[model samples]
Target: TLADAIFRHLDHGAAAGPSLAGRHALVTAGPTHEPIDPVRYLANRSSGRQGYAIAAALAARGARVTLVSGPVDLPPPPGIDVRRVETATQMLAACRAALPCDIAVCTAAVADWHVANPTDRKMKKAPGATAPVLTLAPNPDILAHLAAAGPARPALVVGFAAETHDLERYAAAKRVAKGCDWIVANDVRPETGIMGGAENEIVLISADGSERWPRLTKEAVAQRLAQRIAEYFSPDRSPA
Candidate 1:
């Protein structure tokens, strides 16, 4: 009953105004794993909390939510459809398959590079203690691909910028480079704990400029982002 009530309120809040009812929202979450060997892999520290919460929020607001996640432990949200993938290539393929949505949120911290070819069997270490060399190749940029996917591109394409320095400067450049409608930028420094922590601070970057958001829990950020997406998709809303 509680979940039902909250959903009802969200529906009313979105629909009473210019809402995203009947629109499809696609979200990517977690970190893609690149296999090195049968027993070893490469990945980041993404928890997928923010992205999953955003999917839940969009679902609450009456959007058809499609979550393409990469090995998250959390269960799928109440009213969202989820597709799981392990590698960056798989994630891109899934996004292509789920194209033409009203919005696409690229929240996954996909690896920039992956092993050219993973060994089928476990790699044995040398008795002399010399480390084995691994060759890496760049992975496809899923967010950039979605934004430039011709007519199938969503009305609003959003990307996440996890940066270490020059926060807004790099974020703005990333937004322009990715060709997305918005980029949610964050500093993942040690104290802030943006990677694996529950709380986060983000700045919204768009064509006009940037807006620094207050520190909040992951759930709150999702709700706020969902609301902004709803407004942005409305017939009367502008980039402003």
Candidate 2:
């Protein structure tokens, strides 16, 4: 009850202004785990720091933020609604339920494929019986689904591209393929220390072109991105 009251006070504009007071934002964060069995699962290295920061930033701008998050250790940001999920399918469903929002940002590193036939019980070695095979199935593409043309489609949909090679080309192509308004591209190679790290270096690709941003704290990036979204929704700008 104390947490709820605190969040309510923060949501009531205690620290945030009213620039984006009426807007609603939907964000997906963390790494979705695809189950192999009761004891085994597949996941990525995402820490969910960036997405959580983004949610906090948007909330600070006065937008109602609904964060559909995957399994992570981070605490929920104040003045935001956080819905936790474990798989990509669940994440998509949660995102759909929070739709008709003004902004959607897909920052979760969702698995591209999941075990099609997960065992009900824990898998065992059993003295090495030729190693059990795992049939992989394609997971639902949440970003593209949100970017699809429809009445519930958000005005701005942003996706993240964590690439190890050909970052710009791949990110741009992904933007086109996903039909999202923007793609935040980043190098996630282990050497870059960007993945699962506290700082980030990103190149924002949109219809307007790419803008390379300096390496900064994840919170800083979130603030800049939130400011950009606020600018896009400013009263003076003509609707796209």
lDDT digits (tens) for residues 1-240 of candidate 2: 999998897675333322677999999999999999888998988999999999988888889999999999998997799999999999999999998899999999999999999988888889858888889999999999999999999999999999999999999999999999999999999999888899999999998789899999999898888878887898775322
Best by TM-score: 1
lDDT of 1 by residue, 89-129 (tens): 99999998997798999999999999998999999986998
TM-score, predicted candidate 2 vs. hidden true structure: 0.91
| Residue 62 C-alpha lDDT in model 2 | 82
TM-score of 1: 0.92
Against the true structure, what is each candidate's TM-score?
0.92, 0.91
Give per-model CA RMSD.
2.6, 4.1
| C-alpha positional error of residue 198 in candidate 1 after TM-score superposition, expressed in Å | 1.4
